[model samples]
Target chain A: MKRLVVMALVGLGLALGIAAADTPTTIRRDGVVLTIPQEKRAEVIGDRLRCLVCQNETVENSQAGLAKQFRGIIRRRVVKGETNQQIIDFMVHRYGIFVLLKPPLIPLTWLLWFSPAIALALGLLVLLLARRRRQQGPPPLSPDEHDRLKELLS
Target chain B: MATMLTRRLMFGLPLVAVAAGGVASYALLERMGRGTYNPQAFNNPLVGHKVPDFSLPGHDGHAGFDQAAIMAQKRPLLVNFFASWCVPCVEEAPYLDAIAKSGLDIWGIAYQDKAAALDLYLAKNGDPYRRLASDAEGRVAINWGVYGVPESFLIAPGGEVRWHTAGPLFPEIIEDQLKPALQRLT
Candidate 1:
């Protein structure tokens, strides 16, 4: 009976340890608690999203309070086992591409997508036009200078 | 006629010089603004200068991870930016834990993760970070020049960022690149 009780206690301890290992801790800061499952996929998702407040920052790097809220939102989605694209799409719908530091290419943002090429073309056109004007113009020479050069040679 | 030609040349020369100077200055300023001229630009070139003041709740839920305290120590440190949802970050997790176990001062900033989920991750995989700061706002990662997850930085005793490796670091990288860099930092 004593041996059985000891064995049962040890087994319970092992079981609890395993459970605790799998149970993720809830990190509470400033007024938010981010709950993440102890898994690999979820970690990646958190890193991919951009922080809305900090324009160039991904959700993972921004310290703005809004970033904390966004992270919480991502963590909830990850816990729900959403696919990466699904998670990203969900945020895109909520906040539009502006929330994404690296916004995906889509039809609605065609102007932003192609403006660089357009700007480059315009710059090249200006350079070519300037060069053409330079080529078309004749070199200036006064009559006296021209006559003096001819007299010197003669 | 010669005097007139000389006068014309003298007046025109200054105008040409001024125009040339103006054009050159504009081009230089444009290049600087676009950041095209500096081929080798650093994100957080300010490392070793001084670590920024960051006071955030730690992963453990009870304490604050102070940047100043971490910098005050003489030991070389490994600072990593990771997220729970990143695939590469998942792959690098165990390795970071291993590095921490090797008696090094390893600190982590959860780039953009929730506090609860981060806790869950550490509980499952094991916490390699002595103290993990939640960069739920990504403010710290930006300061650190982290563009992606699984980026690691090795800081020397004086707080200079000696080495920066971006991406999922492999075991061989640890043996070859990171270990050597850490050795040099110490």
Candidate 2:
């Protein structure tokens, strides 16, 4: 009975440890506590937004004071039940599309999205045309040249 | 005939592609150059929007900002975001002082700076702000969508942001861009 009780206690401790591991740590911002899910949503949104001050770093990765405050703003909005699009739109409205790390597919960005594909297609077409020309073997060397080659061999 | 056409296309197509690529890249580069330094050419999202209201602690022995009272003055307000740590802010101080003396209602919001340092800087350089507000955590400046210091906004009587300029204000910029905007506001 003593051994059984010890095994049961050990199992319970292991189960508790697993449960603790599953729960994400919460972050406090401006006196508001963000739950794990809320924090995750904020992080996802933050990762998509650029830190305007740092220029190259995303809001999620930047340690700039502005980025921290931006994260806090995201968390606050998340806690308030704003959708991801709503948060993004709010940021874009204030900071312009430059704030988005991955800008949406729009008319302005059409060249950016399609230029590489167009270039690749053009390159492949050129290669195929060149290969076909090479396979044709120099236009059969012309009929007169063929006859001249045959007489020389004879 | 087909081979001749194919050969011609093989040479012509690449030239056309190169020309197109050159033009496209030039256009893109020009656009990027314009977007970086020319804030006026690119539309500022904050322009025409109502300025966000903020009240922060006062520095340099002035009372804190009161947005309602500022709007109550019924004149165009020039809100300058500066910091004691920012070198451009120091360089632009005399221009701000000159603008203030010219009878424009100018106010300052100290961005992410301590009061003591701000006071020392103001004492040495000359305090140009009529009423100075301290943004210790920089929340107020963030609300204004200010990414850099030495940014100024000209607010219309009803609190609409008429014009905003980034970087230190030069005398020419004041005369060329700022003065014209202020004139339109009045």
Candidate 3:
């Protein structure tokens, strides 16, 4: 009887979960369904974008009102049928490149983005050079071992 | 031999487990942090979108209300989501009252608080909200993406949310940001 109750509960839980998952999400405007899942894509893009007010925070993570406002703006544009590039352009114009958490691939920001890889390579090169130098140096020989070897050779 | 093997296992086992656990935790945190804001979460700005359906009791309880109708008013509606306990809401009360007096169609939703307390609050602070709705259970707040109290949304004539403000709507943001959206809609 206990097993049957647990099974029934599990089944009920699954049904509720499925029902909640099946909730319709459609963006409709002026009686016409936008049909395109632009909001989903906009969220993905916004999350990648940074919040300028809190420089370290991405639009997704920061609860700063500005981030929320920007997310709303992005959503509005997407619903208005703007492309991703156009939305990005709008943000860049308004907030400047500082709004993007992931710095864009530009001449000025190339160093900011690629400095970590360069530093890593330099560190590895230094380690390799030090290791080679140590390897090329004469091996340490204990006094007793050296004396024994010298005596045997004589 | 068994003792030596046991000693090695004792040291190696914990090290492996710790390393595995550390790596797993790091990966999980990275994955979690990766879900930063994306545009998709907010694709529909209230232009022509069906207003988010929410029914809540009024401050009087005698007159219940729906958000869609208030939002679909001929004049643009300013919906402020506030809680009696929210400090920011208290701070912004004067500004809101002023804005409403200026003939802006301002409405308030008392988010997740008692209607009685809200009425008392308005009596004390000055009623800025022309019509107040009671969201005692926070259902309406969730549908509107309200994380905190004192958030505001400006709804256009078509019952779409035109502008959203997460915190206290300062004079500048209202003047610069919100005014533009309202003008465009009108």
**Predicted candidate 2 versus true structure: per-residue lDDT over A1-154, tens digit per residue:** 9999999999999999999998768867644699878878888999999898788899989988788888888888899999999999888877778888997899999999999999999999999988997888855578999999999999
- Assess every candidate by TM-score: 0.43, 0.70, 0.44
Q: Where's the lowest-lDDT run of ten residues in candidate 2 chain B?
A: B34-43
Q: Worst 10-residue stretch by lDDT in candidate 2 chain A?
A: A23-32
lDDT scores of the candidates, listed in order: 0.70, 0.84, 0.72
Q: What would the per-residue lDDT of candidate 3 be over residues A1-154, giving only the tens digit for each residue?
A: 9999999999999999999898667765323344447757777778878775465787767777656666776777777888888988766643456566667899988898899999999999999987997889876889999999999999
- Sorted by lDDT (best first), the order is 2, 3, 1
Q: Between candidates 1 and 2, name the one with more favorable lDDT.
A: 2
CA lDDT of A78 in candidate 2? Answer: 95
Q: What stretches of model 1 exceed 4 Å from their correct place? A: A1-154, B1-44
Scored against the native two-chain complex, candidate 1 gets a DockQ of: 0.02
Off by over 4 Å in 2: A1-25, A29-32, A114-154, B1-43
Chain B alone vs. reference chain B, TM-score for every model: 0.70, 0.76, 0.70
lDDT of 2 by residue, B103-186 (tens): 997888899898788888988889878888888888777777787788899988878888988888877778788999998977
